[model samples]
Each structure stands twice: as structure tokens, then as C-alpha cells.
Target: MIHPQIPLILTALLFSAFFSGMEMAFMAASKLQLELQEKQNSLTGRIITHFSTRKARLTATLLIGNVFALVLFGIGMARSLYPILTAYLPASWQYPAVFIIIQTLVTAILALTVAEFIPRSLFMIRANTMLNVLAVPLLISYYILYPVVFLVVGAIRLVVVKLLKMEFSEEKPVFGLTDVDQFMKKSLYQHETEKVPEVDARIFHNALEFRTVKVRECMVPRTEIEAIEISEPINALRQAFVQTGHSKILVYQETIDNVVGYCHQLAMFQKPTDISSILTPIIAVPETMLASELFVKFVAEHRSIALVVDEFGGTSGLVTTEDLLEEIIGEINDEFDEESLLEQELQPGIYLFSARQEIDYLNDKYNLALPVGDYETLGGLILEMHGDIPNEGTIIQAPPFTITVLSMDENRINTVQLVRQAELTAED
Candidate 1:
């Protein structure tokens, strides 16, 4: 039931009531600042734009509203207590203690209930309404009492900020990467029981984690690159290009040392007969290009692979649109992309593999930089480590992965099984 002394009760909490209005006014001013910041919207950019404005509004509103609320509340409480204070006790003790108790209790009630809880809730729910309703009257109140309120409070603000050695700013709340992760975790859907899928949650976590990994961790290395030499026979180049099933080829003049440019296969289909026309240049990329930049370059050029180069004019490796895209989204499979049988099942968290499988590709997936230069693939890396090619069931220690030769042929390493050395984290 509404208390019979509704106005009197409100008047008793008048300090709080006015504070609530002032707090809401602060929120309104903050909203205006945020709108200004959001004009060219970006989370970081908007936050930066609003930072000073938010601080200014928060400070000004807090100061002005607080003073006005204090005055109103002091008057209301004193008006309520004047008679009781005089009648109940001797003059000295009655006035002093009563004034202290009333000031403390009423201030506590106003600050906790009206000023804090109500204003915060209203700001969260209907920021605009709070701003318009509360800020307008409070602004008028501030003007009416500026001489008294401004001088004392301004002195306090200046003194506090200076002594603290901090620039004046309003504290703003923010969420961090880990905080977002935890927040998403708590936001459960009643119908959907599954926490973001093991794969998907990890991917989200990885996207957060992606900022931590640089491009070097996921780039193709120089040794296994299958690039076309300017002098390479047209028939051989064409056969290799077709066999590799790559969309773009890096055409280098000598030893991939003199990279001229790139040729797209679609262009190659048109010039089937002209031997000179077949040699197309490729767009080259520097190894230092971040994953973000590589993506931008790929989008603009409409090309997939770029030859990773060094400052001294030597071919480093290659990166494809598919490779760069992997950083943002998890692994994507194209029609040409095939997963080895070893990948489909996690038998003992391991897989059996053909010894002939290119180990460099294995390295690409796991980031295990094994010794892979002597032969073409992982089997070759093993052969180079051993005096001669080992028979099936041969165990090897390639960083980030462990491989056992399931089978091998006399001519080359044929079939083998492999497993990751570490638990597969999505970021990898």
C-alpha cells in the first residue's frame, strides 16, 4: 500500500530522490556522448570518442546533482526533525546528535536506494528517458545554486584529482576477451543444452587467440614449394601445374631467385599453344606480411597463392587464400582438399598413414618443423635422418607429432600412421 505520508516519506528520502534524478541525468549526458562517438561506429573507435565526453558528463552531473540533492535533503530532513529535536532532549545534545544521526541515516538511505539502485537500473533499462527527465531539472538546479555548489565542490574535485595524480575521468566498465568467454558460457539457452560445440567454442576461443599468433606460425615454408622456373619446359610445367591442382603458379626466372610475377590457371587455359604465353607471373608476398594483410591482398587481387619472398630477392614459401582464411575461420575444405583417413578417426587419438604422405603438409597442420629437405615428403625427412629408408612400423620423433611407418615400399616410403604429440587445441 502507498504510505499515507507518501510525500513526507519521499521528502524524508528527498536527498536520495534528487540524487536518483541527478544520477539519471549523468546517464543521459553519457548517452549523448556515446551517440556522438557512434557516428562512425566501431567499438574501439566509439569508446575512444566517448571517453572524454563520458568523463566530462559524469563529473559535471555528479557534482551538480550531488550538491542539489544534498541541499534538498538537508532542508527536508531538518524540516522533519526540527520539532522532535527541540522537544525530546536538552538543547545542546538534542540538536547536535539528532542532526548527526539524521544526516547519516538519510544520506545512507538516499545514496543506496534512490541514488544508486534506482538510477543504475533505469539507466540500464531506459537510458534515454532518464537522461531527458532527470538532466533537464537538475541542469536548472545546478544553475540556481552554482555559486555555492561550484566553489566548494570544484575545489574538492581539483584537490582530489591533483593529490591523486590522476587526470579527472569517470570510471567506465568494460569487458575483456576472457570476460566475454565467461559471459557467453553463462548465457545458456534452455532448449539448447550443448555449450557452444567443442569445435565451435574452441574456434571462438581461437579467434580470441588468433591475435596472439603471428603469421609465421602458420605459413608454408620455402623448401617444399613447387614453383615454376622460367626455363622449365612448358610441357613439364603444365603437367606439374595440373598435377598439383593449384589455382595460381609463381613464375620465377632463375631458381625462384628472379620472381617476375604470377599466372592464373584460368588465363593459362586460353593460351594453350603459345609456349611463350604459357609462362605467367605470380603475385608475390613477403614472409613478414601479417595474416590480416595477406587476407586483404588476396581479396583485392582475386588470387589464391602468393610466393612468400625475402628482402634479398629469394623465394621463401607460399600462402594461399585458403591458408589465410584458416586464421579467421577454422579449416575449410575445397573439392580438391582431401583429408587422410588418419584424420577422420581419433583411434587412441592417433591415425595410421601411408609413408608416402608429404610430411610438410603434416607439418602445416601441426606446426611441426621436422627435417624435411632431402626427399619430397615426410617419409623423405625420416630417410634423411636414418642412414637408409626404414621398414614399416618405424617410429619417429618429428616435433609436434609422432609418426610410425605402417608400411613402406622398396622405392619409397609408402604407408605410415601418425598422431599429434600434443592435445589438439583449436588455435593450432
Candidate 2:
């Protein structure tokens, strides 16, 4: 006849296998996996994420469960052997040696077969899918057993800290911005991980940097700011709006320095007599304001764009919500934006660019060490280096690269060619 303890032993071993697999699955899944799963709006993903975030609690739950299973297994094994020991063994021989030997042999066999090897191997093979399947049951079990698990974890911590006068702190690891950037880029570049795409990774990396970027860094400079004089004819204002491709135009009274407010192009439909009739009061922000802070301000104030002002209260430039977002997510080109504005790669490590391309974009995209102070664009950089308007086809040598002026106006660089020295040497 099968021993009464046999069912109990099987139950314990079954639970042991489950707990082992659960532990392995949870451990093997990365944070990136959790994030991607959550993005997909999966309930299992959310549950796993909840547990992952509370690692200490999850760990305690797993340890408590496994320990309890082992204890049950031990009790079952002892009970099953008790009758045999009493009937077959001599009293003295049955003392501890036979029980110990039998229990150790059984434990070792079960540990390898049921508790350690099979479950772990299966869990590791499909960690994410396993976690998704197990999350619901695991979460249910977690709630039911949480009180006991909490007490056990608390007692253990109390003993380690107070009784032993030791510190046992769990330092959760955090991925730095650089680490995240590299991870996302590599994941996309290799296309090995389907969760993070190239566009998403690039945008995420830029978004991380957006928090630290200042308004001045991405603002359209005063020279580039399209404005209309309040005294100008409505047709003149229409031309300015059409030419600049801006829905909102800065309105100044006497001079561009005296920016009074802004007028939306749609307001032209109202056929107001003057600029003031359609003017909306603009938010003026210091150039030093963080893009993140500016974003919050823009949201709270219901403003899409703000006039970036210097310490003297003169308009230095303008920053829009789009500009701030583009700082994090890359440029958002609309129908209004010229398609040719985007920098083009002519060859490996060689590019064709407008002089108007921001130095920040160049540095971020190319990892260049171009100076930012008193200059904002490649054209500005070339001008500062040459101390004059560079003639068309004139070559200026910057270490590791050379800039050739392709076209220029009297004041600003229109287009240029950039060639890396390494590529030039390779071609030669």
C-alpha cells in the first residue's frame, strides 16, 4: 500500500519545483523586459513589475515559500520512514544513522530532479512567457501569504540589525543616463531585442537629455526670429506669417527689440484694425530656465511658445513647446518645415549640412567637441574660426575634420560640407 505520507511528499516536491521555477524566471527577466511589457498594457506585465519594484518583499516571499516546502518535504520523508525503521531495524541501529542516510539520499535526489534542475531549466528557457503565465497565481499566493512573509522578513531584519548591531540594506541598482543610452542604442542597432526600436531608443535617449537642457540651447536666435511691426499693413503681416511658416508671429511696436506681444495667424480672419486687436500676451522667460521647468510652465500657462529674454528684458530668442520636446525627442518636421533642413550623410563620416544646424545637434549626433560659447551653429563656428565670412569653396581645418563652405550669403552660412580626416585618409 502507498504510505499516507506519499501524497504529502509529492505535494511538497511539486510546490518546491514551482517556487524554484518562479525564482529563476523572476531573476532572469530584466527591467527592460518589464518596461516593454508594461507598455503593451499586459496585466501579467504589470503584476511582475509590481513585484520587481518591491524586490525585498518578493525575495522574502520566495525564500519563505521554498523553505516551507522543504520543511514539509522533510516531515513527509521522516513520517514515511518511521514505520519501516521501527519494524525492520534493530533499536540501536535505528537511532539516527539510518534515518539520516535515507533522508539525505531522498533529499539529494529530489533536490536535483524536482527542486533544482528541471524547473530551473524550463523557466530559464522562456523566462518572460513563464513570468506572464505565473504572475496571476503568484500574485494571488503573495497576497495570501504576505502577512506571514512580512513577519518573517521583519524578524530576520531585526535580528540582523538590532540584535547583531549590523546593517543589512538593499541598495537597488539604478541605470545611469549614459548606461541607458548605450543600452537602448545597442538593443536597436543589433535588432536582437524587439522591444526597443531605433526611433524609440533615439527619442528616449534625447528625452533623458531634455531634462538638463536649457531654453537658450535650443531657442531660435533673435536673428532668426520672425516678427511683424504693429504699424505694418495686414498684408505685410500675412506675408511674414506665410514666409516664416509660423502660426504665431511676434509683434513689436517700434523696433524688433521691443517685442510687445504675439498675434496668431488665424486671428487675421477677424480682420482686426491693428496688431493689438489680435495680440495675445506672451510669456517671457529667462534664457537660463531649464527646458523641463519651461515645459511645466508652458503647460500650466496654456502657452505653446515663450519669448526667451535676456537679463535686460530684451528678446534674445523664442522657445516653443515643440522646440523643448524636440530637444528630447528629436526634430518634429511638419509640412511647414523645409525637408532640406535635415543634415544629410554624403558618405561614411562625411555630411552635407546647412550652416543653420545647431551646434548642439552636431555634438549630440556626431559626438563632436565643437565649442558652444558665443556660437550656436557650424556656420557660426566657422565664422569664429575664420573671423570673417568664409568664401564659397574655402576650406577651414578643424582637427579630425574639415569644413568646406558650399554656399554663403553676405552674413550667414547657407550650406557646407564636412569630411572626417579618417574617411579622407581611407579614401586616399
TM-score of each: 0.53, 0.63
Q: Judge candidate 2 at residue 72 and give its lDDT.
A: 91
Best by TM-score: 2
Which pairs of residues clash in candidate 2, taking residues 3 or more apart in a chain or in different chains?
none
In model 1, the worst 10-residue window by lDDT is 28-37
C-alpha lDDT of all candidate models, in order: 0.58, 0.80
Q: Residues 359-402, candidate 2: write the lDDT tens digits.
A: 88788787766677777678888988888877899999887879
lDDT of 1 by residue, 70-167 (tens): 56655655565566567776767765767778767865675577666775676656643455445445455556665766575567678779887766
- Candidate 2 residue 427 Cα shift, in angstroms, is 2.6
Give me the displacement of residue 62 in model 1, in angstroms: 6.9
Candidate 1: count the clashes.
Answer: 15
RMSD of 1: 9.7
